[model samples]
Target: MTNTKRKWFIYSLVGIGIILISLLAYCIYLYQVINDSRTSEMDTTKTQLLEQTSYVDIHSIESFHGTNSYHVLEAMNEAGEDKLVFYPLEGEQRQLTVFDMEDMLSKNTLIETWQSSCGSCKLVNVTPALVEGEAYWEITYHDNENNYVMNYHSITDGSLQEQFKYPKMFY
Candidate 1:
């Protein structure tokens, strides 16, 4: 081929390579910006949730059975009168419970009922939550071998409304 033609071909290849590299860098920068925005949005959502609920108090409860250890938390719900929220720290199944704070504190009927229902499981935390305009209790419990269980018990009758078990692995 002629020298001029060869030189033009090389120049074109170099230009294309530079353009490709620039595009890749731009894509990477865009991805990072998007990821950061998403993180910020999540933080804002969490803050909004806390503000909407107006939790008066937060409590952490820890329990152990044999070799298993359980971590639970309770938060008072100011948005709803006589309500508490409960949840567990880490597990395949995370549970949230909202129940009548007054009944839980005074009568302790929910705890008693839970004991009766699952003798092997121990209550970890109780929190009040508003679910679809209805008040509910989120209860976290730990059974044998560090197994985490979550139960939503009705405040009216202390009946188990929903339940979940933590998965062993995330993926």
Candidate 2:
């Protein structure tokens, strides 16, 4: 073969080899980036779960209010008292009510008292919670159309402190 032709053939082979090596290196870099991102996401998820568990202490309470539309969960605080946490099944608002157990048991007239104070909302359930060492009532109720409602009433004065309402559905 001619000398010039032989030189061109060697250069072509070198170029092809360089291209292949570059492609392989790029693939390896992409693999490492994807793996690192997945690991970071998993670590973030684990951390969020741990923080949530530490925030709410789980408790065993029977006859919690609501059907498939809402959820009421009981948790024991650091003071060894039950706290009621209310949230809608698909809504955004969440409420935490803390009171004393003995105060709730002695207040049998709480439902009747709430009925007159809460307008048309019917009393559903009453859970005790303690707020800053002060006992309060976490009242759960529903309107005529089954819309969920919550009221935080002071145990001492029977005055409403906070109220929450959630509609039946969200589009």
Candidate 3:
């Protein structure tokens, strides 16, 4: 309409744009901060394993957070044997638990055991995990109804220890 009204409208639009840009920048910064903390934890676990155990090499490390925090490293021992190193983050005394991979049930075998009962579910990746100092294989998958599921099975006996399911909220 008038020149003064158009100027006011443009100023309002600029202010809103500035606010949105600031919000986006803050979210990106927050995400980076959280990611850095997790990466640092993984690095600390690797250093601890190398110093405190006979493990000579690490193939991979997976971070797990539940009742407790843990970093599970697929590693090799001084005797050239594949091992799993579990380093717990919470406790008065934190000790590294080194397990022989051969002694534990294989991922394929464990997956087969679960698959037999959940034929219609879709399997996701399985990672080595620890619960209260005991070693377990954590399996993540989507059920037939599209609900997210987590099944923790004992590595020694291949028995299910616990399961957590999260139903999808949005279509």
Query: RMSD of model 2, in Å?
Result: 16.6
Highest lDDT scorer? 3
lDDT of 1 by residue, 13-55 (tens): 9999999999999999999999898556444534443675566
Better of 2 and 3 by lDDT: 3
TM-score of 3: 0.81
Residue 106, model 1, lDDT: 29
Candidate 1 is scored at a TM of 0.38
Clashes of 2: 5
TM-score of every candidate: 0.38, 0.36, 0.81
Look at candidate 3 and give me any clashing residue pairs.
none
Model 3, range 38-156, lDDT digits (tens) per residue? 89989888988888778889999988776877788889988899988778888968877779888999988998888999999999879888777788889999999999999999998
Model 2: per-residue lDDT, tens digit, 37-155?
86564444334333664434554332233332223345555666664443333445433344444444334677778777657777777865444544556788888777898877786
| Backbone clash tally (model 1) | 18
Candidate 2 clashing pairs? 98-129, 98-130, 99-128, 99-129, 99-130
Cα error, candidate 2, residue 126 (Å): 0.6
